[model samples]
Target: MRRRRGFVQFAILHLLKEESMHGYQIMKELEERSNGTYSASAGTVYPALQELMEQQLIELDTSSDKKVYSINENGVKHLQNKHLEGDFWVEWKERMMWRNSEQSIQLRGAVDRWEKEFRKAMKHARGNPESVHELIAFIDDMTESLSKKSTKQGDRS
Candidate 1:
């Protein structure tokens, strides 16, 4: 849903690296492998598979009832060149789990700091309207600074 092109591509390549599967099978595999974090709907998976077919990364197994797909030489080369062999998604999922936990901790720390800062600032401005004005000015300045930094980074990227 987030429209991560790289993530989708990586999933396809990873799936093919293991073995051949159909679109539905790939979707089920992805959901199970990612622990439900990454799910490729038919709409998304089918189109991506079509693109990969067009790119000659995979070939269809038209000799069966189900339209299965297997990695071709190009797909194998792609996987090998990418240095992503084995169940690469497993390691990625593990790292993501740890990263999420770390982020939760960091978010808690940030929220606590923000609360403390806000309380202190409010206490200092209890009777002075000028402090409120200064707070607004500070917020505006920080917003402008963040906007500029974001714009510059986007430009660089």
Candidate 2:
């Protein structure tokens, strides 16, 4: 679960949405918030900042020596469109715990219990194999419903 996808972009935008910060401060905040899971180097973060500026999503305050970066109107609109950040942070925390072997035992226990319950439900749910089309549709619906419920639960946490 060591996800290293568009996380750099999300982390940068997620922090800039809160308040203006310089490049070094942004890096530190990302590291602290992610518990060092995303301790990206300047080589990783600076280019994204530059790209955001190029896209006119962020503005640089050169009045001070720090060169603070503040999200502009366009950035706000972008974050609103992309939903800033939520689920990614939750998954990142879970991954960290699993990696450190801290809460993984608990997580495994919960998942195992859930699987047992789900199989029990499936036993009653499974009907004649002659209804293959209905079975497929039912499975699809269950997947969508479970995914949405899990997403809502994640957001709540």
Candidate 3:
């Protein structure tokens, strides 16, 4: 998904405004806030935190083994000036609401199970052209079947 430049930074600042958090906590909080749509990685979050520190928008407490980050007064002013509370959050919530549904939860579980099995099968099929071809054909057929079912459902709707 393409994102606007500095969006990660903006999100980091928004999160820090609420409370101090470690890197992992920031990643998890971003994921949770976006309803699993935006999964923040350490690579992304840590660098953004470093940039925020450089800009003096946030501060890091290294008193403990784990570095905790908190938004400073400048960060609050930045958010206020930019008006962080806006349609971005409303659109994000609307877009990701499906992920919070019971049906979506079950579908996610099934997809995860399928992915695990697919990975195992791929590992076993490595270097075997015939096995790989069969797997591709099976996946193609499954995708076509699902597409047709979806089309039929749309017609009903």
Report every candidate's CA lDDT: 0.78, 0.77, 0.83
lDDT of 2 at 76: 82
**Candidate 1 local lDDT, residue 157:** 80
TM-score of each: 0.55, 0.54, 0.54
Encode model 3's per-residue lDDT on 91-139: one tens digit a residue.
Answer: 5565457666788899979988998999999999999999999999999
Native-referenced Cα lDDT, model 1? 0.78
How many residue pairs clash per model? Answer: 0, 0, 0
Give one digit per residue, the lDDT tens place, for model 2 in 28-88. 9877877875566898889889888998989999999889999999988887787534576
**Residue 98 CA displacement from its true place in model 2, Å:** 8.0
Distance from true location, Cα of 66 in model 2, Å: 1.0
Write the residue-wise lDDT of candidate 1 on 47-136 in tens digits. Answer: 888878888988999888999888888988887777755568777676446545768779868878987897789799888999989987
Worst 10 residues of 3 by lDDT: 1-10
Evaluate residue 95 in candidate 2 and report its C-alpha lDDT on the 0 to 100 scale.
60
| lDDT ranking from best candidate downward | 3, 1, 2
Q: TM-score of predicted model 1? A: 0.55
State the displacement of the C-alpha of residue 113, model 2, in Å, after optimal TM-score superposition.
37
Q: Give the Cα error of residue 105 in candidate 3, in Å.
A: 23
